[model samples]
Target: MSAALMALTGHAEDRTAAAREWRAAAKPVVGYVGADVPVELLTAAGVLPLRLAGSPRADDGAGERYLGRGLDPAVRSILSRLLAGDYGQLDGLVVSRDCEASLRLFYAVRELRRIEPATALPPVQLVDVLHLPHHTTTRYVLAKVRQLRATLEGWVGHAIADADLTRAVVAHDRLRDLLTEVARLRRRQPARLTGTQALSVVAATTALPVERATELLQRLLAEAGSLPEAEGHRVFLTGSSHDSPDVYAALEAAGLLIVGEDHDWGDLLFHRRVGGSTELALAERYQHNGPSAARASIRRRAAHTAEAASACGARALLCYARRHDDGPPWDFPAQRAATGLPAVSLERQPYGALDIDARAVAARLRVTEEVAR
Candidate 1:
């Protein structure tokens, strides 16, 4: 492969090949459903949870035919490509009832393409997050996990014992340690990691097997650690799906590097697991992420956002709500007041068209950075 191709593939050039080995090492060959699903659970289950997403190169013709009029054309287009075979390689899929788009995506996956000739598309597991009340939702969630565990056991032809759970944690934690280093370097040094490159890190859980990802990550970490420190304005972002390295791309292009973030998909959610094989460790793993699929009272949503905002050290917070997303709406008011920091709210129609005006964000930060200097 060309050097350019190697870079795009990150640590492992042959993730598909690595995945086959991982599946052999693991049982059940599971795929997680939620963006917030703990990598530990799948690792422990001997499953590989690959995050599903849209990329510019993907074509969505067949996906459009699947969803019909259920979702908007843009969302359907993305789904068309994904279901049409974008992530057809995954053994099983985990679906979160997180938002309109995500929920719809889950539904479409379960309803359509329930079978494929090449491989079994992941069995869809619904995370019952109907947000009516805490107790009610929690019980539903716990039961769902049990069901998923049972399903996974059947797939593997054995059970996930305490030892298995603990072992998965060890392997996954090793991977997270590498990620944490990368995240810290991004903060302490600033911009060593980009938003796009960051997503590739998150994408690793599903895209490659544990052993190979760790090897690639080890190489990347050594290289990243040797890079020079980043000096400039540091901004914290709290939003959905900012893990794709666009932050690295955009901020680096403007001569600023993202030092920290409150985004749910990366550091915030990534830190939720460690050192436990107990059911509680597993349970807490799924519940504490920044956002959820359940419809909560407006108050709860704001609380979650305030958390991400305050915790992420955002000097300037960009609300990357995908045009009418409830997750961001719930967090807006509290997040606006959570920090003394200045904030920017950008409505995104999709990934390629982040309605955020680059000039506007840069102009605002430029003045602030100068003032700080």
Candidate 2:
């Protein structure tokens, strides 16, 4: 088998292992963090926390009927899969006001619990993102979080403790540092891993103990050799669910090197973590930094891409979303016109459907490289 396929299978295995690890170690694992939900909050609550978006893609079509807008085939399939007993094992789901699509997805699931009391699916509901000042799109998030927490606490029959939150903060902070080290390895040699492999970092981030993840990263880096020379084109992407190494992979595949980006799963989620703080403090810090609460995750995503274009030595900006994914549309036009850099946009479908032709994307990148050279 080709290295890519083998790696894909292995990556899936790693995810399974990580999820089982988290579930076995911590019950009622929650996967609701977007951009900056605090690990301490979940950890302190004795909940196994995972990022819901990281699950291997499935067909969720049943989710479409309940959503009001932007329901694409991919989204539908994923939701359908969910309703068909794919994620029935989840004890509860935490939804963030991530985007129109995500918000709708959350609503769809939330409604199910209300309408179908006997459904095997776990508790589901919306997460209000406290929108940033001047960005009223998600101002209800804070109240929503508190309410959600209370609901979660009541259901679990135990409230999340301040002390537990503090411990979670320490653990999360360590995880952040550990991920940073892994990012460093990518910066040095983009080929040592792929975007999916990098997802192992994210998977482990939500599941594995920070220390173990760190050791694995360190070991991975030890084997990382120099990046195989590229044709020297570079691009920064802005979109949904980007793992850092995945950013590098898209760039390289498009014949560019990834120097920077603003995707939450890429940078904002992994930006920087405060150290040695209490759980409440740590939760507060995450709430403060995460873009999930931003007025527009799209606009926020765009601005980050704009900034990266200048600083990351990028030759072009790529603003693409997975097919039917609307996360990039909100701020893309403005970003493309204003960044003073040429940009390319695409609609990608998980690891499966890449609506944008690879060669075409690569060709543009090559053109940029030729000019740069």
Candidate 3:
């Protein structure tokens, strides 16, 4: 791997490294918890947008004490870290209503700050963008986006001009374009990069500065042709979002080459571009981009997953939903039927547990392929 790829992967693995560096330089950093938050607005507000990711290694006992065990493990992990002051450098935090877990996380954080005054929690904001495709939904989301802009402006103590937003939009659009090219490379006949590596590359973009992320991506793409091609049964992943590449690494190690995944941390992160520079355009783009497991209908989710898997030339599908994350499992049956491919569903998986019988999975995929042939 090139030095740039290594650096980006490092950032992905160490989620808070870039944010800490930025804070040490006396720059303000605003942390957001989910993919639904409009990062471009934060960039336009003259603050670094730090994407807050959860760790599988977090203390589940402590998390359960505060937020209870009913929440997704990823959300629990984030809450645990916040309680431990792991994200003290954040100037503010934005929680999106992208899923039920995240929305509940926002409420939990707010109540914790109230009851536990000594805890080092940042001021939090919520951006609720309803996902329904209707005029009222569009209007509501546009208002929410504008409201987020106002909140960010209040934090920076200055107006975020249209020019600032325009520049930010352009930069993000370029970054998305570069990521799309990287996706194409990953889908090549013999993938130039493994799914684990691709997840790291995409996750790093959320942690680093946009310009730096784009530069690193360009460097990686330039050096991609020289990387060793991955070999295994081509597979598509659809389930809970992956904050770390541990599962991908494990699956790839077991002879399953993950070419694509429809999770927020992977290809879905840049699925849509801000078609225009205006707030309304941004709202429309996100509200209608790809079908999200949490918000879109089962048919929509199934069609999107099928299209993405076919486009990537995947031979099989793997649906791995974490315990307590209900959305993905609800869509699994439809997704499997829509794809019309050999599929496996691993439900109620524990966080950080790589106990998947991946060898058996690989064998099954091979047998299915031979039978089809």
Number of clashing residue pairs, candidate 1:
22
Residue 304's C-alpha lDDT in candidate 3?
94
Query: For model 2, what is the alpha-carbon lDDT of residue 68?
Result: 35
Q: Which segments of candidate 2 are over 4 A away from where they belong? A: 1-14, 21-26, 54-58, 72-78, 134-145, 189-196, 207-215, 221-232, 242-254, 274-287, 290-294, 297-303, 333-339, 347-352, 368-373
lDDT of 3 by residue, 35-120 (tens): 88999999999888988888897676667887788889998898888878776668889999989889988998888779987886
TM-score, prediction 3? 0.97
RMSD of each candidate? 4.6, 4.8, 1.3
Which runs of model 3 end up more than 4 angstroms from their true locations?
368-373
Clashes of each: 22, 26, 0
Q: Rank the candidates by TM-score, best first.
A: 3, 1, 2
Give lDDT per model, in order: 0.56, 0.56, 0.88
Ranking by lDDT: 3, 1, 2
Best by lDDT: 3
Q: Per-residue lDDT for 1-373 in model 1, tens only?
A: 2232245356322334545665566534444444545556566666665555454335666666665654434456556655555444556666666556667777777765555534335556666444343665556666766776776676666788878777877787787777776676555534565554555565554566666667766776767645555555556665555434544466546654455555545665465545566655555555554444134444555565555445444456555555334465556556667554566666544553444556566676767545656
Q: Which 10 residues in a row give candidate 1 its minimum summed lDDT?
A: 1-10
Model 3: worst 10 consecutive residues (lDDT sum):
352-361
CA displacement after TM-score superposition, residue 52 of candidate 1 (Å) = 1.7
